[model samples]
Structure formats: C-alpha cells, structure tokens
Target: MKAMRDVWGQALVDQGAKDPRIVVLDGDLANSTKVDKFAKAHPERFFQMGIAEQNMVGVAAGLASIGQVPWTSTFAVFLTHRAADQIRMLVAQTGANVKLAGSYSGLLIGAVGKTHLDVQDIAIMRAMPDMTVLAPGDNTELLAMMEWANAYDGPVYLRLARDPVPDIFGADYTFEVGKVRVLREGAGVALVTTGTQLSRVVEAADLLATAGLNPTLVHVPSIKPLDADGLRAAVGGHDLVVTVEEHSVLGGLGGLVAETLTATGPAARIERIGLADTWGESADNAYMLNKHGLSPERIRDRVLTVANQVLASHVG
Candidate 1:
C-alpha cells in the first residue's frame, strides 16, 4: 500500500521524463502533496508559489496559455476554497489545459481541523463548467489518472488523499476516464464507493455476504462525466444502491448517482453514506472517521441494516 499523493508525485516525475510540456506548480506544499519528488527530479519544470494559492493558479493559467500542461499542487481545501475564483475565471472559463491536484482530501487531515480538511471539494469542482473531476481509489488508479491528466485537455481536478491506502488495482490496471470499475460481483444490491473509502467498502461487501446480503461491490473513481452506462447497470433492477464517499451527501458521488438514476427512472432506492452538510473538526483521523460513521465496522453495520430492510420490504 502507498499514498495516492506519492503515487501521483512519482507519476509526474516519471512522465516528466517524456513530456516536456508538463510543469508542476506548488502552493508551498510540495512535500505534503508529494510533488517534492518531481521538484527534485525536474527542477526546471517545478515552480514554487509560497502559500499564494491564487497566484499559483494564475501562473498555471499563464503556463497553460503557452500549451504547457501545468499541474497546480496543494491541499484540497486551499485549491477549492482559496483559489476557486481564479480557477473558475482563468482556467475553467478559458478552457485552459491546467491540471489541479487537490491533495489531502476529505476529513482525514489528521490534526489540521475543519479549516484545513476539505469535505466538499468534489461538489465545488464538479460545479465548474468544462472541469473534469477525478478521484482515484488507490496507487494504480492514481498513476493512471495522472498519465491521463497529462494528456487530456481543459481543466481537470484530481482529488487525492495523504494517507496510505490499500492496493485496489493490480499491475495491469488500465484507467478509463469517466468510467467506473466494478470490483466484485454479487446479487440484489450494489455497494458503491470511491477513493480511499474503497477498501473499507470492499470489506463491507464481505460482511454483507456473511450476512447473506450478496452485495455487488462498485468503485466509482470518476465522479464527473460519470459512467452512466456502468452506473445504470450497477443499480438497475437492484433492490438497493448504497453510495459511499468520503465527501458530503449533498453533491458528491451520491448526488451525481441520484441525479443520473432519477433522470432515467424507475431507479433503485439509494442509500448515500458520506459526510453531512457539516464542517470537519480537529481530531485524530481514526476518531474523526469513527465519529463521522465512516469506520469499516460502522459501514458494515449500516449496509447490513439497509440490506435487511430491503429484504423485508420485498417479503412484505
């Protein structure tokens, strides 16, 4: 297992060897965002913009104007909150080929508290016109997305976590943009999740199976340009569709799934598992996750209950 940020930084360093137009702009958080490796390997292509996240976006915009694929690296909160206006105007509106990497996503910033952690970045980035949103579940998926982002056009937001995550994809994994990967096969229900939340939900599937729920595990890596066909197939005809994310229930994967499914009703009932319309707090990562009902045991229990209720409804 490796941190997705580390995988991304390494991807930049490796890809930079071949792609000269790839430039890395950091908001004085190279080490935290794991772009330090790229800085060391390709100093000529790395720009350090100290804590000025907005200026960093402008600089990246300028680079993009010249056809350079400039990737701005910073915390998810700062990139979305601090430089949103600049990103919206200079990057998204202009259709600049700028890649924005929002590291340390979700409510897992360790002790950084609500101010540092980003609980709604997915919603914010997804709202931007012409913006492509992606959240890779593990090292393999992160590497694939970085490679794709380096070549894709327009504004792209890559959400990543700072913590080490389990390996969900193997060596031969190929990532398709806007496509969701079905991780396991089962019956009756689909347990959908994305990002680092994948491993836990994979476990939750097992727990559900032990309880005779027979859940189909789903990993929705691409939150925007969603895999509509894949999503429909996953949720179609199923009694329940459980969407889990490290983000809020308002406008993350849950919202996207709900919107897409409802548009093509009669859709399956959705059970969204994510943060509420609430801010984060200063606490240990485990404590915060448990408090927010994101722990594996909590997720398992929640899925189990939902499965039972659905079964009972059918019986009735």
Candidate 2:
C-alpha cells in the first residue's frame, strides 16, 4: 500500500526533471500535500505562496499563459472553496494549462476538523465548463493520471486522499481520460465507485458475492468527460446500480451517473451511497467512514438490502 500524495509528489519531481517548463506552486502546504519534495528537488521552479490560495491560482494562471506548465497544490477545501472564483475566471474560462492538485480530499481528514475536509470538491470542479476533474483509486492510477494531466492542455483538478490506500491497479495500469475501468464481472447488480473508496467497494463486492449477490464492479476515475456509452453498457442491464464515493451523494459520482444515464435514455434503478448532504466532523478515519455509510460492511449491508428489495419486487 502506498499513499497517493507521496506518489504525486514524486511524480511532480520526476516530471519537472523531464520538462523544464513544469513549475510548482503551493499554498503553504508543501509538507502536508507532499509537494515539498518537488520544492526540494526544484527550488527555482517551486514557489511558496503562503496561505493565499486565490493568489496562488492566479500566479499559476499567469505562469500557464507564458508557456509554463504550472501545478498548484493545497488542501482540497482551501483550493475549491477559497480560490473558486479565480479558478473559474482565470483558468477555466481562459483555458489555461494549469493543474490543480487537491490533497486531503473526502471525509478522511477529520483529525484536522471539518474545516479541512472537502467532500464537495468533485461537484464544484466538475461543474466548471473546461475543468477536467479526476479521482484516482490508487497510487499507480494517480501517477498515470498526473502524467496524463501534465500533457493535456486545459485546467485539471486532481483529487487526492490523505492516507495510504491498498493498491487496486498493477504497474502496467494506464490511465485514459474519460474511460471507466471494469474490475470485476458478475450479474444482476452493478457496483460503481470512484477514488479511494474503490478498495472498500471491492471488499463489499466480495462480501456480496459470498451472499450470492455477485455484482459487477466498475471504477470511474475521471468524473468529468465521463465515458457515457461505456457506463451505460456496464450497468444498463443490471437490476440495481449503486454508486459509492468518498464524496457527497449529491453532485458527485452519483449525480454524474444520474445526469449521464438520464440524458441518454431509459436507465436502471440507481442507488447512491455517500455523505447525505452533510458536513464532516472531527473523528478517526474508520469511525467517520462508518458514520457516513462508507465502510465496506456498511456498503455491503445497504446494497444487500436494496438488492433483496429489487429481487422481491421482480418476483412479486
């Protein structure tokens, strides 16, 4: 298991080495976001912008306008909430080639209190017109997505988790923009998820299989530019389609799925598992996840209940 933040930091350093056009800006969170490694490796290219997130984003936009690939790093809450206006006007509107790295995303950063937690970032970022929102499931996927973002020409938001998560992909894993990855094949139900919540959803799938549920597992790494046809093909025939994420059920993965499926045509019954439009509180990781119904056991139980209900309705 490896932390995605660590991989992201190292990837930035490696990318900087390859391309002199790459520069890094941090909102006084280099150590927390793991961008200090990049600062250490490339001092001249790194800019410490203190706690001013809006200014940092503006600087990044300016750098991008001058043919520099600028990557700005900060806490997800700070980046999304504090610098939202700048991001919308300078980066997204102008189509600046800026990469925004939002670390400590989701409900896991409870130790730092609710102020530091950011569960609505996906919704906010994906809502922007030209912003590319990405959430990687593991370290390998993060590295691949970072490389892709570096090469892509637009505003990109990379949502990263806090702690070390189990690896879901191998070293051979490659990330493509707007492609959904199918991890397991089964029947009746489709278990869909994104970001660090995937590992737990995998465990929940195993538990459901033991109980004869046998759901097909799908991972969505790119929230924006979602693979609509691929998603429809993956979950169309299933009786129950469940979308689980470490974000709020509203306007995140669940909302994206609903928007996509509803626009295309008729769709299967959809269920969303995540924070129910509530703010995060101070607590440990395990407790917070359980409280928010994101734990593997909790996910399994909820899915099983809904699956049984669907089965009964069909039988009746």
Candidate 3:
C-alpha cells in the first residue's frame, strides 16, 4: 500500500500529459507534498511559490483566470489556516478552476502533532459555496478523484492523508462526484466513512457483523457535494448512522450526514466517531488513533454498543 500523495503526484503527471491546461504550484514543500514528481517531469508547467502559502494561492487564482487548471499543494494546516482568507475571497468567491491539495491532513501525520495536523479543513472547505471537497478512501480512489477533478470545472479541495492505507475499492471502481461507495451490503447500522479512516471502518464492520450487529458499510468519498440521495439510499433502513473520519465530529462527515438527514428527515440517529473539536498531540499513529477512539477495536466496540442500544429500545 502506498500513500495517497504518491498516487496523487503520479496522477497529476499522468493528467498533465493529456491536458495541456494543467499547471502545478507548490508551497516550497514539493518533495514532502510529492508534487516534486510533477515538477521534475514538467518544470515549465510547475511553479515553485516558495513558502508563501497565501501568495501561492493567489498565484493559482491568477492562473485559473486565464483558463489554466492550477493545482496547488501544501501542508493541510498551512493551506487551510494560512491561506483561508485568500481561498474564500479569491478562489471560492470567483469559482476559480483551481484545485487545492491539502497534504498530511488530520491526525495521520504521525509525530507532527497538532501544529501541523489539519482536523478542521473539511469543515472549512466544505462550507465554501463553490468548493468541492473530497476525501478518497484509499490510493486507488485518490487516483480516480484526481482524474475527475482534472476534468471537473470550478474550485475543489482534495484532502490527502500521509499514511499508507489498504485498498478498499477494486479495479473496476469508478468515481462519481457526490457519490458514495457501497463497500458491503447488509442492514442494521450504516458505517459511513471517508479518507483513510475507511480501513478502520471496514474492520469495524466485520467485527460488528461477527457480534451480530449486521452493519451496512458505506464509504463517502465526496464529503462536499455529498450525495444526499446516495447517502440516504445506503443508510436507509438502518437503525443507526455511524459517520467516521479523522476529522472533527462537529463539521466534517458527521455534520454533513446530519445536515442531509435533517433536510430529508431520516429516522436514523447519528453517533459521530471522531475527535470532539480537539487538537492532536505528538504521538505514534496507533497511539493517537487509540487515544481518539479511532482504532478499529474502539470503533467496533462503539458500533456494538450503539447497535445494542437501538435493539434494546425496540425490545423495550
């Protein structure tokens, strides 16, 4: 298994070969962000914008105005927090055909701690009017999203985790923006997940099934422009909707699912499994995941607890 950024960088090079309108901009972290691959292959189309995150975003906006599909890559915290104002005013407001690649997102940055981790990026990016926020389940899905984003018009935010993840989608998997991937079929509880958290969610689904929870596993690849109907369809008939992610429970996948259910009035109760608007600390990936109740075992336990509760309520 390879990192999502690895697939993303190579995919950017592949897309560049086909689309001449594609341009890449890096925030002085090309090697770390993996955009260095694109810079080496297409130096003329690649722009090294130093460490000025805000200015780099501005430059991407300018390039987008001239019909170039500018892809800007940087650390997630820096790209979202450092350049939020520019992103809101320049890219989202104008609906520029720019794609923002936020690398090292969430608590997957191993020992980088909270200073570099981005836990609120999905919430911030999805809140934008024109931004299409995506968190691919694995590297293969990441490649699909990159190709789709290349052909897609307007602003997009690609949330990439730095950790290696298991392949959940098969070779025949096709990416549809705002669509969910049904990983497993069943009906009792729905395990809706995004990004690298999918690995744990899938494991949790199995554990839940062994415990007789009978979960329906679903992957939400597109958080923003989320498939409301698709989510409803996958989550329909389930007693509980458990949204999992490496982000905050407030405004990421959990919030988006809640909003959709509210708009449609689904009778499922949501138990958000993620950091509760808290910052991460310097620790090993497994330690951090366990600390935040994101481990597969923890998720499995949570699902069993919630599923039992719903079942007991029916019995009562």
In order, candidate lDDTs are 0.87, 0.93, 0.89
The count of residue-pair clashes in candidate 2 stands at: 0
Ranking by lDDT: 2, 3, 1
**Model 2, 9-128: lDDT tens per residue?**
999999999999999999998998899999999999999999999999999999999999999999999999999999999999999999999999999989989789899999999999
- State the displacement of the C-alpha of residue 8, model 3, in Å, after optimal TM-score superposition: 1.4
Model 1, span 143-212: residue lDDT tens:
8888888878888999989888998788999889888788887778888888889987887778777877
lDDT winner between candidates 1 and 3: 3
Query: How far off is residue 245 in model 3, in Å?
Result: 0.9
Q: In TM-score terms, which candidate is top? A: 2
TM-score for candidate 3, please give it.
0.97
lDDT of 2: 0.93
Q: Which portions of model 3 miss their true places by more than 4 Å?
A: none
In angstroms, give how far residue 112 of model 2 lies from its true place: 1.3
Q: Which ranges in model 2 have alpha carbons more than 4 Å from their true place?
A: none
Compared with the true structure, the alpha-carbon lDDT of candidate 1 equals: 0.87
